[model samples]
Target: MERIRRLLQRKTLYEPLEGGSESPDGEPIPHSKQQPFSWLDYSVFLLLGVAMLWAWNMFLAAGPYFQRRFESDDRLLRNFQSAELSVSTVGNLGSMILLTKLQARASYPKRIVASLVLNIVVFTLLAVSTRLFLGVTASVYFAFLMLVVFSASLATGLCQNGVFAFVSGFGREEYTQGIMTGQGVAGVLPCIAQIVSVLSVPEKKSEQGAPLESSTSAFAYFLTASVVSTVTLAAFAFLLSRHSPRQRIKRSLDSEDSENDPERFVRKSVPLVRLLKKLFWLAGAVFLTFAVTMMFPVFTQQIQSVRDPHSAPRLFQPASFIPFAFLLWNIGDLIGRVSPAIPGLTLTSKPRLLFILSISRVIFIPMYLLCNLRGKGATISSDVFYLLVVQLLFGLSNGYIGSNCMMGFVEWVDEDEREAAGGFMSLCLVAGLTVGSFLSFFAAGSS
Candidate 1:
């Protein structure tokens, strides 16, 4: 045990001169000791990232299913859109508030656990609410549903901030990448599950009462999502229990000297104003990245392929295009997130280039709008393949550029500042989501 403890303790290799910290070559070296992370460290970071956002992803992916539940009543359908927007807005608000106000004061692991617990409770309630309130009045049902949506969003915000802070402690670029990759997977898995659930239901002989069928499907989908949330909560708990370099370093440093506190070594409370000024551009990039990307589910689903009157009905119907587009976007996002692992793909060194690419993503909005969906004007093309390709590229750019921006921001600050940086960036991300979700309402109106 003593040998292990000694090995885990970080050792200072060089002492700085009294007058200056610069070396002979005039390069200023960091005074903090560094601990190298192993493969296990990498794996844990990646899994935590995945688990952190899985519930949020599942919630977003279930949009179609939830929307379908009110197909019978046009009034309820219109209200559903408002409710959807509220959920996103409230959720983002919750996350932004938590990260901005409480991140520095709260313990990261405890916050993460709290968020996961909230998710389990909220999801379970969603599942139970669907079953119990299926026959209730529309007003009552929507009210209950909105409460669940708000709760889920709050939990998501808390979890995302906690997860980002937790992983940032490792101070490894790959750990950031792992978390981003997990986020992409979170989007993908839920989409796949939705597709499977949709396919499993038998085709009805008559098209009458489609709304009833949709409601039933919605129940099953929410139930599945709740179960997944439960599993994710369990996995997160297990991962949190394991030892990592960050924990080991803190433990050793705490044992060695109370005056040289490890927690204090890596975290300093900087003025929010100064922090915002330093991170403005990076935060804007993250905001724009998510804003443009959020438009996808909001607008893309409204686009339908120009129907072929002469063709027979297919097994994977054109209606599946919405989910398929979602799937492609997520897969492309995963590919993009993984791309930085390749030495040649890393562009964090070039902030200008990355920022330009991120801003250019606005082009996708117009491209998607002009596609032959439910828009007001002439469409450039009604080709389903064209839309799919566009979605793939959109997802690719979103993941790649978003990851680069996030990782670059982390690297820009001192090791002690990384956790706060993560929180700030998370706040930006939520801001973007909220703004984008609001914009989605306008996009919906235009259609």
Candidate 2:
């Protein structure tokens, strides 16, 4: 009905108001003004596209590559460091979430840019510094890989929250759907990245028929992914600069909004207490869901430990099991994203049940642990199969939980609080990711 009214209003306005439309008063005329596309509207779409692609690229080459490098290869030192990396990466979620909350009360494009740039630079430098200090070599590169995983996890968590907060705007439905869709699509990048990894040129042999060395690892595929990601990031930065609070410098360049009144600079900031009260329930669910989700990483570590003396060596292998598991998980999530029908407009018949079902993952994780720990050899393959089934179901549970919980939270908050809620959501998600990583690595690595 609202959309229909807007359409009708647009049509009526374009029709020239029937030569003297007035509302029962001695007025000359009333004209309908179509709202102009604001910076907020344009930036949301721009960021949505870029963020999805950016996240996709981040995970595409990185997930499988890192899984194999840090978790697959059984280097004692690397294994130990990977566990450390998990804790640091997870712990960083606390800082990342808090910063987002702090930044929520204001919108300054330069500050946003500065924050993002600093976060990325610090993250990258930490990894590079660790690599150089440890003297990275294949023999001990697992140590560097551990640091890289840690840095990437932390950076990705921060970047995700930051990007969404700056980019998502007023209203619940469009914004929440946009996030879910982008994340869903982005989450699939590894499925394709796996295929791309297979296409890299193998090293050619010399006249002596001894093969020359090649620099690319299966994970070096991420270098290409990173380059692609850089392009998306630059585009996002450009769009954001044009449409975000960061547009101050651009305004100086173009001299637009020079006459800006003080009123244009202010937006109401919500209270922290108010925002937390709305999120309290969903926050618990998110925390529990993510904590349980850690079992997959643990399962991945165990699977990579599998060896067969008689099987042929294969290049460009994927964490096929994990991705497949998520594919199933995402399907369930899709179902949750769209709920079932209701009768007679009973408010009680709403889709809140989806959120409840999603919480079942907490129960499922223990079963996964029991299956994996039961054996190896003939038992390992069967254990892996059971783990995959559990993950597929887990994905379904995630879909239901994620679909409604976020939307419900947004509905409960005010317009101002919605922005703060976005930051809180990110914090909770990262905290979960961090915790999951820490527990998984410890369990998987502990013999």
Writing each residue's lDDT as its tens digit, candidate 1 over 1-447 gives 998777655322121111111112222113223446557657655666666667666656555555555555668766686676678576657766656665434456666677767777777777676567567666676777777778777777776777776666655678778888888887888778766665667543222222123545555656665665566666655554453333445545555653564444333565567667777777778888988777887766676555552362432353455666678889999999889978789987776787688799988877876776653433665455545567888999999988887777765665556667777888888888888888877877776
lDDT of 1 at 171: 58
Which 10-residue span in candidate 2 carries the lowest summed lDDT?
15-24
Model 2 lDDT per residue over 88-107, tens place: 55646766755665642344
Which predicted model would earn the best TM-score?
A: 1
Off by over 4 Å in 2: 1-81, 84-88, 108-154, 195-214, 217-220, 237-269, 303-355, 369-388, 441-447
Deviation in Å, model 1, residue 168 alpha carbon? 0.8
lDDT of 2: 0.46
Error of 2 at 382 (Å): 6.0
Q: What's the lDDT for all of these models?
A: 0.66, 0.46
Clashes of each: 1, 6
